[model samples]
Target: MEHVRDSFARQKAMTLIGASLASLEAGASEIRLPYRADLTQQKGFVHGGIIGMIADSACGYAAYSLMPASASLVTVEYKINILAPARGSLVARGKVLKSGRTLTVARAEVYADDGTHVASMQQTLMMLPDTPDTPE
Candidate 1:
């Protein structure tokens, strides 16, 4: 947990966007972001790209939390579906569906603070071989 929190704290983009790590566990994590006009689309809803970014990061970190200390992860691909306008503070919850030696699969769902589902994401991440410099 210390490592996970430390790793998350180092992500500058999360700080820049006012995103925070809300929770963390062995195979799960959540991030929250407040709604800011600067982060919205022309229609005043949170942009889909921001939603995707948090989703990806949340999922990636979830996978990372379960990885061995020497391993590192990189997202190989992901797909996201925006289902509703994100008009309020948002929370993205990510969970590992499968952890493999070479590949990992995770899912994330973003929801408006009001309980509206905003987006869903599925990600495939590659687990790189361990290296001495790996942070965790």
Candidate 2:
């Protein structure tokens, strides 16, 4: 759990929420991201793409924390569903559905701070072997 705390604390984007999601571990995370002007659409709601990115990042990190230190993972596929328009602030909750040697499956839910479920996503990640370091 110390590694999870330290790792998220050092993460730039995830740290935007301060401690909201910083204490997240293997089970679930409640992440927050304020809606800045850059994150809004013409209708003054958070953009779909931004929501997708948040969901993807949450799931990826959740999977990464469960892997061995020498392994890494990348998204193989993702499916997102926009449930409602997102406004003001956003909160994404991520959970690991399954973790295996070569693959991980996760789900995330994006909600407006007002408690509206804005989107949901499921992501599949492909675990990769760590690259060996060579003497320079």
Write candidate 1's Cα lDDT for 19-110 as tens digits.
99999999999999998999999999999989999999999889989877666678999999999999989999999999988999999999
Window of ten residues with lowest summed lDDT in model 1? 127-136
Supply the global lDDT for candidate 1: 0.90
Q: Score each candidate by Cα lDDT.
A: 0.90, 0.75
TM-score of each: 0.94, 0.81
- Considering every candidate listed, which one attains the maximal TM-score? 1
Regions more than 4 Å wrong, model 1: 132-136
* Model 1 lDDT at residue 127: 81
